[model samples]
Target: MVEVTPPEGSQVVIEMWSDLGCPWCYVAKHRLRAAIAQRPDADRFKIVIRSFQLDPRAPRKPEKNEQAFIRAHGGTAAQVFQAERQMQAIAREEGLEFSLDRLHANTFDLHRVVRYANDDGRGFEFFSNVQDGFFAGALNPYVPDALEGVAEAVGLSGHRVREILASNEYADRVRADRAEGLELGATGVPFVVFDRRVAAPGAQKVPGYGRLLEHVAGPVPSERVS
Candidate 1:
């Protein structure tokens, strides 16, 4: 029952539900950004990054690599490996480098920290930084030091971040975000709602996002009839 309102003067408010560890969510974000950039009134759009956990039961420690995680989750070795390769190719198309060797872990704490950042208007930036670091294989976010490094990179207070992680700060917001998304009919990550009017599911292509934006916000002034 959380209320979502567009920022002042914004023509469109884009709320996206995605997990930090989901590869398709990463790609979908990039595509959405690309679509926004292509718009003449790009600055009129406000994006809110909603939280979702692909696996709430995941371990806090990096106990297994991507392959092992997939296999343990019921995917065959051949299917998992092939899917990883395909994902890599798809990610590359979105200007991201993917290395599926990274370890899997629960993202609840990460979501908590990001929710804290949302209060300061740095949530999306912080989330993107962590995802970039994780997917690049440059760091394991499950580790406190690595998580702190990303927070610092995003200009977040290291002490504040540590304190939030030490406690359950923003935990309710994280859970509420996921709950709201589910209520809105999202069954998976990368679910997007434009101006709370058009609901789009999955990691759609760049043009697909553009179309959704246009559908909700309508054509820019230049394209409007006098």
Candidate 2:
């Protein structure tokens, strides 16, 4: 079990820049969660998700599998397949499932849902559910009804989701998040920034995050501090 509180001056805040269609980002999310859970003072830490779009050129519908989109965007299918296998192995270790057959759709609206979730104070849970919907079940986020279903499942109103999809609600927030990531020197997704003190870029391991957290929150002596 983890404590909701930690020693004074020991709180850590992490900002993760990620995209829904990015395989490594999904793995990174799981690793962060697992690492936090391992700490006795998990609740003292907060993980804020910052949006990034790996495939902004991706269509708004499911035209093909992710590989096809990547191929159309210039990468070879074999390359995508090889990367998928490696990522799937890592995801499995983190108790996450990946559906490589899923379509690669534009993530703009999906990110809007994330902002709304943040407004509702359920951003983290909504982000987790979106990851599961995309990687575990291949749900297409650009599909309005499908996205609404996901929002409803996470306790968000389907009507509100539909409204968001219908308009440009929270669109600026998504763009602002990406801008912040870029300003932080991120040229890619899965960039983890810890309290403006440390920045790690990639699908880092659980222990890697643990080390970062420890460094940020100070040493945990005898697990009592945590």
Q: Which stretches of candidate 2 lie over 4 Å from their true place?
A: 1-11, 66-73, 221-226
- Candidate 2, clashing residue pairs? none
Which is the leading candidate under TM-score? 1
Q: Report how far off residue 109 is in candidate 1 (Å).
A: 0.3
Candidate 1 — which residues are off by over 4 angstroms? 1-11, 223-226
Give the deviation of candidate 1 from the true structure as CA RMSD. Answer: 3.2
lDDT of predicted model 1: 0.83
lDDT of each model, Cα atoms only? 0.83, 0.79
Looking at model 2, residue 56 earns an lDDT score of 74
Question: Residue 224 lDDT in model 1?
Answer: 61
Tens-digit per-residue lDDT, 32-86, candidate 2 = 8888888767887888888998777777766556455575666877877887788
In model 2, which range of ten residues has the least summed lDDT? 1-10
What is the C-alpha lDDT profile of model 1 across 175-223, one tens digit per residue? 9999999999999999998887778999999889888877777654476
Pairs that collide, model 1: none
